[model samples]
Target: MSPVRMYTTQVCPYCLRAKALLKQRGVAAIEEIRVDQDPKQRDAMIALTGRRTVPQIFIGETHVGGCDDLVALDQRGGLAPLLAG
Candidate 1:
């Protein structure tokens, strides 16, 4: 499986939901960057994704966008192949 990373806040429901979906998809670990606590990480996340939003997700080198984007990818039958990469 490719590496999974998520930029999240402590109390983000979308972040939690995103994690649940990832878990269901057999993701054993997620490198969570808590941007709520660290301003630097938040800046990095924005710079990398071009969006300042909680739950910015990266499946390996692919920027998977936010929670809804992930669900859409799964619905389109693309997430599994991306994860497998």
Candidate 2:
């Protein structure tokens, strides 16, 4: 599977849901960047994604976006293939 990375906070429901979904999709390890613990990381996340939100996800180098976007990708049958890479 492609490497999974996520920008997340400690108590965000969307982050939790996103993690759960990724785990269900066979993602064994996630490089979780906790924005809640560092202001610089939060700024970096905003700059990288152009959005201030938890659960900003990436599959490999591809920005897969947030929870809803991830779900939509999975629903569209794109998630599996992307993860396989």
Candidate 3:
């Protein structure tokens, strides 16, 4: 599976959902950057993804976006193939 990275907050339900979906899709490890804990990281996340939201996700350098985006990708049968790379 491709490495998963997520910009997340501690109490964000979307972050939790995104993580759960990645886990269910056979992602064993996730590099979680806690943007909420570090104010600088939130700025970094915005700079990197152009989004100021928790649960900004990446799968192997490909930006998978947020929780709803992830779910839509999975439903479209794109998630597994992306992770496989």
Ten residues in sequence with the least summed lDDT for candidate 2: 45-54
lDDT ranking, best first: 1, 2, 3
lDDT of 1 by residue, 1-85 (tens): 9999999999999999999999999999999999999999999998998999899999999999999999999999999999999
Candidates in order have lDDT scores of: 0.97, 0.95, 0.94
> On residues 1-85, what C-alpha lDDT tens digit does candidate 2 reach at each position?
8999999999999999999999999999999999989999999999999999889999999999999999999999999999999
TM-score of each: 0.98, 0.98, 0.97
**lDDT digits (tens) for residues 7-81 of candidate 3:** 999999999999999899999999999987899999999999999988999999999899999999999999999
Look at candidate 3 and tell me the lDDT of residue 30: 98
Give the range where candidate 3 is weakest over 10 consecutive residues by summed lDDT: 1-10
> For candidate 1, what is the total of clashing residue pairs?
0
Stretches of candidate 2 exceeding 4 Å from the true structure: none
Which residue pairs collide, candidate 2?
none
Off by over 4 Å in 3: none
Comparing 1 and 2 on lDDT, the stronger one: 1
lDDT (C-alpha) at residue 25 in model 2: 93
